[model samples]
Target: MICYIYDGSFDGLLTAVYESYYMQEKPEQILRKEHFLPDFFIEPIYIKTSKEKAYKVYNAIKDKVSHEALKYVFYVFLSELKESSTLIYRYLKIAFKIGKDINLHMHNGIVLSVHKISNKVTNEVHRMLGFIRFKFLASNLYYAAMEPDHNILQLIMPHFSKRFSSQNFIIHDRKREIAALYNKEKWVIVDMLKADGEKLFLNNNDEVYEKLWKQYFSSITIENRKNRKLQKSYMPERYWKFLTEML
Candidate 1:
């Protein structure tokens, strides 16, 4: 069995795919460096990420495959599902063979798997878009923190960046240990693995806003019309921790 190991970036995954096709050796599994387990029987090949190689593969997908196929590839990558690397490799293999109609071939296992994972990622993005609540910080920034199941910070940043273009903000993904920092002019993602959440500078007026919001939420709640199950279905319990009213 052959295992291809790479850095955890999407570009690195594409580079691994490029190497596999170039070497004419298909790997049984493609794993990130942290996930690769050593085995005497399995041949492990470490793949270095190359921008040129990754760009080539990306261009091929864009030029040869349909735009929808490229979109699916990105969405599936963002899904962060187990064995997503191998799934993407297999999906691309079949995609290149079957042409632009590959997505239409739902009977194909790889195609179906990619489609399902992409749906999961899309759902998570939509949920985050609705669930995210920002708090005014003492630093004059709007800050929000969340621990989404998938790596969707990048996917959802554009929405907030556009809506709050005039203000500076930070969207911290606790699970991923990363933060999307947006200034009034532009935005950038930063590694915040060691960031102290407790040190977040909250505005003095935040408490007043929180109290007012919670009171408004309580006033609007209809005791007779309350449906816990339905509410949970719409807004998962996990997200309530970051919501001001839920707090």
Candidate 2:
């Protein structure tokens, strides 16, 4: 068994895939460097991230395959699922052979798995678009915090960036210790772990809006028609911590 370890980045994974194809040595497993553990029986190969190699593979997929297939590849990577690198490599092998029609091959296990993982990540991105609640901070920046199950900050940024194009904002994914900051123009992601000392300074009037939102939420709910189970189905409990009305 051979294990290919790479830096934890989409480009890095693509580089590894490119090397595997060129070297004619497919790996049994593809793991991020941080997560890779030595196996006595398995030969471990460490892959360095190369932008040139990554770009070559990326362009091949985009040019040879359909753009839609490329999008699916991106979504699957953002899923951060276990052994997703291996799954992506498997899906790509078939995708390259079958071309754009690979998406229609639902019977293929690798294709189906890729579709499922992509759907899961896309679903979370949709949920975050509606559920994210931003607060006005002391620095006059709109700030929101989330603990999403997937690495979706990049996926959801374009929507919010276009919607709130004039405003400066930050969406912090506490679970991943990363934050996306928009400066009324373009957005960028930053490392924001607890130890980073990046404080969120909220204005005094922030509490006023929070109270008003909570009050409005309560007023709109029909007491007799309240259904906790139904509400929970639409809005999971995991997101309650970031929701002002839920607080």
Model 2: lDDT of residue 7: 90
* Model 1: lDDT of residue 237: 97
Worst 10 residues of 1 by lDDT: 196-205
- TM-scores of the models, in the given order? 0.95, 0.95
CA lDDT scores, all candidates in order: 0.87, 0.88
- Candidate 2 regions exceeding 4 Å error are 195-198, 201-205
Candidate 2 lDDT at 244 equals: 91
Per-residue lDDT tens digits for candidate 2, residues 48-161, read: 999999999999899988898898988988888777888988888898899979899999999999999999999999999999998887678888889898999998999999
Worst 10 residues of 2 by lDDT: 195-204
Candidate 1: regions farther than 4 A off: 202-205
All candidates: CA RMSD (Å): 1.5, 1.6
